[model samples]
Target chain A: MTVSDIQKLLNAKVLSCNEKLNMEVTNAFASDMMSDCLAFAKDANVLITGLCNPQVMRTAELLDIECIIFIKGKEPTDSMITLAQNNGICVLMSEYCMFETAGILFKTGEIGGATVGC
Target chain B: MAADNTIKLHYDVPNDDFTRAGEASSDLKGKLKQMGISPDAIRKVSIALYEGEINMVIHANGGYIDAEISENGLKLVLCDTGPGINDIVQATQAGFSTALEQTRMLGFGAGMGLPNMLQNTDDMIIDSIVGVGTTITMFIKM
Candidate 1:
């Protein structure tokens, strides 16, 4: 699905990256732990996270992720938004909790990309 | 390829600050890119080193990272004065973290830092003296 599709599905506003709405993303990773995201996430373009910090953007930057969907009704701070804007990363907000948000995305056919070998 | 020209960058890890973690790795990533290093190599080194940086801040109470850039690859030497690991085998085990509740609330201490570093890098060496400190060296081929 695309960022536009997620926006419509969750009734989330396009806080940024309106231009890249058509970009297709095959998978999604939802985690509060930035290290886990960095360690295992590969080829997933959308990050569903509840953590509101600059390191979120930095982690997304390292993975080259294009979209960040903030779950748990959490809105990023102005500084966080500015960082996302500067990084050209699309930002969105969902009222769903992390688990619910992930469930919705997974039910909608966005499967987990790959598991980090234990 | 030709003879390697070494470029070393040192960063003093500040354990008091959780918000400032990963600064060194980000800076190193930018430097490697500016030097025209390949993207694949940069990604490997960035992820591996960033994990180490985060670990140092979380567990070691601060430390130092020395990144050596060369034609062959990027080599990172991370040393920390924090209480050393008591059991290397157990520490390397996933989900075995001693980070406090606050650190986990901040979305860290999942116990994947070391294993993740090992997974991302081509070579990894860890040496530790309990109660003294720990040293980790990792290399990613360019």
Candidate 2:
């Protein structure tokens, strides 16, 4: 799927780096814990997270994640947007909660494999 | 390549500053990318070193990172002057975290830092002294 597909499916608003919407993403990982996201989210290009912080963008950079979808209507700050822009990461905001967003994406077969306990 | 060909990068991690935690790792990743390192090796080094950098901020109150990159691979040395880990065995466990509740609020401290570092690096060594400091050496061979 593409970032545009995810944005439309989740009814998300593109907050930053809109130029990246055409990027392809084959997998999704949802987590509020950055540590777990870093530990187990292997090869997942889209992170569905409720955490809105600059570190979220940093995590995306380290993992080579192209997009970050903030769930539960959480808005990212300007610094977060700037960080995403600098890192070439797309930031999206979804009004749906994490569970609903994950379920929606999972049903679409976009969500990746289950991450085992580390 | 010879040892003289190695590129050495150093960073001073600030204490209790969650916002600035990953800057060093980000800079290092860009440097490696510019050097045309393999993507897989760059990914491994980034994740491992980023985790170590976060650990330094959240647990050690601050630290220093020295990364040496060469044709063979990357070597990272992270040293912090803070409360040392009392149990290396337990600390290496996946769900073991000594972070305070405040740190957890920042969406970290899930106890996956050290284990994740170990998972991404080819070799890692931890040296610590109670009430003194901890030094972690990690290497990822190309």
Candidate 3:
């Protein structure tokens, strides 16, 4: 799936990197804990999180995640937007809560956990 | 152990500043990407070093990071003067953390930092003194 698809599905607003909305993302991981996200988020291109700290952007940079979807109307600060822009990551904010967002994406088959062996 | 081809970078981590914890790692990631390093290698180095950087800020008050990059691999050494880990074995275990409750609220201190570091690197070594400090050396192969 793509960032555009996620935006349409969740009715999310593009906070940064709007030009890259068409970018393709294969998988996603939803978590508030940066540690857990860092440990198990292999090959996941989208991060669904409620944490608004700069570390979220840092984690996305480290993992090469393409987009960050902040749930429950959580907005990212200017620094976070600047960081995401510098890293070429798209930031989206959704009014839905974390659980509902994850469920919607999963039901649409646009996002899911890490896939095991081929 | 300095080689002619090595590119070394250094940074000093500040205490209790969760907002700025990953600056060093972010800088290193950009440098590696500019050098045309493989994405896989860069990802490994980024995750491993970033985790170590966060650990330094969370556990060790603050610290220093020295990263040496060569054609073959990247070597990252993080040294801190904070309270040292009391148990290396337990510390390496997943879900075992000593971080304050406040730290956890910021979406960290889940006890996966060390394990995540080890998982992303080719080699790792930890040395610590109870009251002196802790130093972690991690190598990510290119």
Candidate 4:
């Protein structure tokens, strides 16, 4: 699925990366813990997190996460958005809670293909 | 590459600024890539050492990180002067963590930091003095 597809599926708002919505996301991981994501995530994947902080983006940079979905109606701060944009990682915001966001993405075939925990 | 060795990088970690936590690891990643180390080796070192570095800054009030790269493997040493671990066994447990509530709120402190480091690195050794400091050494063979 693409970033645009994720936004349309979850009815999320493109808080950032308005121009890069067409980027394809092969898989996704939803977690509030940056360490788990860093420890497990493999290759390019979308990170669906409820945590709002610059460190989230930092984690994404290290793991090369392609996109970030902020669940629970949370919006990233300006610094977070700026960092994401600078790193070329798409940032999306949605009103749905974490479970719902992961459910939609998973059901839509953006499965966990990141080879995590292997 | 040095004599029977290769490249070495050392960084001083500052504990006060949480914002600067991953800078050193990020730099090392870039350097490793430029040196043409295997992606697998670099990834293991990056994840393991990054977690250790974060732990030092957050829990140990800052220290130093040294990474020596050779044809055989990568050696990482992390030393910190903060509240040392009283129970090394419990601290090694996967779900044990002493991070503050605020740190957890920032998406850390799940107690997986040390375990994650252990899991990622090929070998790891930790030394600590309760009222003094702690030193952790890790290696990932190429």
Candidate 5:
């Protein structure tokens, strides 16, 4: 599915880098820990994270995550938005919590992106 | 410049600027992309190096990051003079951290930094002296 589709399914608002809305994303990885994302994440197209911080954007840059969905109604800071724009990573905000968002995405066809363990 | 076909880059990590902690890693990431390195290698090196960069800012005040990109692999050396770790083994264990609450709130200090570095790279060596400082060297085959 395209990032735009995920945004529509979750009713998420685009927080930054609107240019990538049409980018296709086949898998999503959810994590609050950047280390887990770093160590085990392989080619995860979308990152569903509860943590809202600059490091999340940094993690996205390293893993080449095309899109980031901030769950639990979290909003991106101005710097985070700038970072996302500069790196060409799309940022989205969802009102649903991490569990609900992951469930919705998984039920909708997004597979588990990363491996099971670190 | 030192050896055949090896591109070397260095950056002085600033201690006072937490926001700029990962600049060196980011710069190196961009350089690797420009050089047409494999995406998998670039991702591993970038993430592993960034974790070390963050560790330097949070624990060691600041440090120096040296990146040597050779034809076969990438070498990263991060050196810091801050108070060194007491136990190297314990520090590498998951979920063991000595970082302040402020650092954790910023999405770090979970004690997975070293482990993450080790996992991403092909080889990693960490040397520390309790009263002196610490230096970590890592290599990733491209």
Candidate 6:
């Protein structure tokens, strides 16, 4: 699925790198733990998290994570947005909770990275 | 400065600024990119280095990383002199952490730092003395 689809599915706001909304994403992983994503995330996967911080962006850069969706209405800070912009990672904020966000995306074939192979 | 075929570098990590934890790893990533290193090697090294940097910041008060890059391989030594670990075995296990509550709130202290470093590097070694310091050496061959 493309990044734009995720934005529309969760009614998320694109905080940065809107130009890459058309970029395709294969799967996603939802967690508040940054280390989990660091270990399991592959390039171009969507990283969904409730923890909003700059370290999250730093992890995204290391793993080449294509998109990040902050669920439960958690918005990223100004510094986080700057990090995302500099790294060319798409940042989005969803009003839905983690379960709802992951469920909707799962129903649409954007399954979890853990459930499937990376 | 003394070697023609190797690039040796050092980075000082300060614990006073948690937000600045990944600077050294990020700088190394950029330098590796400029050197045209394989994407796979770059990914593995960057992830391992970043985790080490974060560990130093969160647990050791502060430390420094000395790196040597060449055709042979990449070697990194991270040293910190703050409350050395008494049990290296437990510390290396996943899901084992001694971080403060505030550190976890910032999305760290999952106890995955050492494990991540182990997973990404081909060779790893850890040395520590209680009340003295901790040093970690890792190598990834190209």
Q: Which pairs clash (backbone N, Cα, C closer than 3 Å) in model 6?
A: none
State the DockQ, from 0 to 1, for candidate 2. Answer: 0.86
At residue A16, give the lDDT of candidate 4. Answer: 76
What tens digits encode model 3's per-residue C-alpha lDDT throughout A73-116? Answer: 99998988999999899999999999999899989875667532
Question: What is the C-alpha local distance difference test score of each model?
Answer: 0.83, 0.89, 0.89, 0.84, 0.87, 0.87
Docking class of 1: medium
- List chain B TM-scores, each candidate: 0.93, 0.97, 0.96, 0.94, 0.96, 0.95
Assess candidate 2 and give its lDDT: 0.89
Candidate 1 stretches with Cα past 4 Å from truth are A107-118, B1-4
- Ranking by DockQ, best first? 3, 2, 6, 4, 1, 5
Worst 10 residues of 2 chain B by lDDT: B66-75
Model 6 DockQ vs. reference: 0.75
- TM-score to true structure, per model: 0.89, 0.95, 0.94, 0.91, 0.93, 0.94
Count of backbone clashes for each model? 0, 0, 0, 1, 0, 0
Any runs in candidate 2 off by more than 4 Å, and if so which? A114-118
Residues A38-94 of candidate 6 have per-residue lDDT tens digits of: 777664478889998889898888877879999888988898899899999999999
Chain A TM-score, structure 6: 0.91
Put down candidate 2 lDDT per residue, A1-53, tens digits, no spaces.
78998899988999988888998888788898998888788778889898888
**Clashing residue pairs in candidate 3 (N, C-alpha, C atoms within 3 angstroms):** none
Instruction: State, as a TM-score between 0 and 1, how close model 1 is to the true structure.
Output: 0.89
Which residue pairs of candidate 2 clash? none
Against the true chain A, what TM-score does chain A of candidate 4 give? 0.92
Classified by CAPRI criteria, candidate 3 counts as high
Comparing 1 and 5 on TM-score, the stronger one: 5
Q: Which stretches of candidate 5 lie over 4 Å from their true place?
A: A116-118, B1-4
